[model samples]
Target: MVIAVRTKNTQTVSDYNCNGRHVFTQTRELERPLVGSILQSMWGVSPTHLTWSALHNSTLVDYSWSVGQTPFGPFSEMSTLSFAQKDAARRNVLLTSLNYSISSAIDVLDSVAAHGGERKLLKHNQYVEFVQRWSLFKYKLDKAVSALSHFDFELALYYLRSLDHDLYGAHAIVYHASQELEASLACFKDPPFPWATVSVYAVCVVAFIYVYMKRDKLFRNKRKQF
Candidate 1:
């Protein structure tokens, strides 16, 4: 994530009447990390090849010196100074906004994934649609990152802004499906009690108690046969 800028100076000299005149000029080169190479190694394709190569191989800043007694002059009066300042301000604002949007999107995604009973409650087609939407969301995020790598802030913002509808749709699908599932589960109630079976059991218990109490009188003549 670090950008390195290098400056090289070239000087010209001339001699006239025992006095020497010297002119110094500078050129700037930008060096970014070998991200494309790393990506190529990992994924077998270099997404940033053209952009990184163009940025690294081109001279970002070039300056020329006019013929004068003094080589250095006031920098505040430069014609492009105001434009550079404005560009920097705009870039800063865009970066801030992008950061907030990305974080919010991630939060939304996490909330959807963490919802309870999403798998059991959602139908096959609904789950499939959710998966497709998630894939699309991630693809857009990747494209936004690619745009950012090339410093295309506006394009990156556009991609980030477009994710809202998909995100909300996914959330609504899970929420409504879970609600329906809960409602269906709530419809089941316990069956009524078996009062007839309980009454038969009570009669059997009373008959057993009566026989136990009369057992001695019923066996009074049993010893006469011996």
Candidate 2:
């Protein structure tokens, strides 16, 4: 037999109410597609490809798509996109996920003039570098999306996953965004190199050293005995 337990959050009714949430939330979501469209144009993709829903500001349209088959295999097309979509998707991902205003990129630059921690103040320049890298990835991802339009569903699907997880997930960023959203924020991951590789490399190196020493000892013993 088992007993169950439940507890309510400690906050009172007033604590649960928020006045500015909807305004901020909607504004935030709206910022994504709008900013995305800007990024798209910057990359030379036509503006029509980036479409938003009439019912809600959050839903974006995948208006561009084509389907045909070739040596690669049969394929059904889902969307048509451009480098701008890719860049916008990435920018949108950062803007939405991190609570960074559309101006976060600019804010980093402005921060240098305000002055605070010597280290912290100079760090914004590094941030500018990271934002540039993210933009580049988006540009590449859009190219991937456009190129994938020709193949059968299976192969095309594989290509999409390779580009971005959000592209496959239910919501799909409501815009074709890259999958590296989480990884993009950190800007880099230290190579822990993973356990399997470390174990394998370690074992191989150890084994090779042991064999070499054993052979040397055998030769020395034979020489001394002789």
Best by lDDT: 1
- Please provide, for model 2 over 102-181, each residue's C-alpha lDDT reduced to its tens digit, 9 standing for 90 to 100: 24433433443344422333235534544454465455455444544442334433433443432222122211222322
lDDT of 1 by residue, 13-110 (tens): 32222224342222231211233233234323322112233648843332222112111221111222233334444566656656775676677566
lDDT of each: 0.54, 0.40
* Cα TM-score of candidate 2: 0.17
Which pairs, if any, clash in model 1?
none
Task: TM-score each candidate.
Answer: 0.41, 0.17
lDDT of 2 at 36: 33
lDDT of 2 at 2: 23
Q: Give RMSD to native, each candidate.
A: 15.1, 29.1
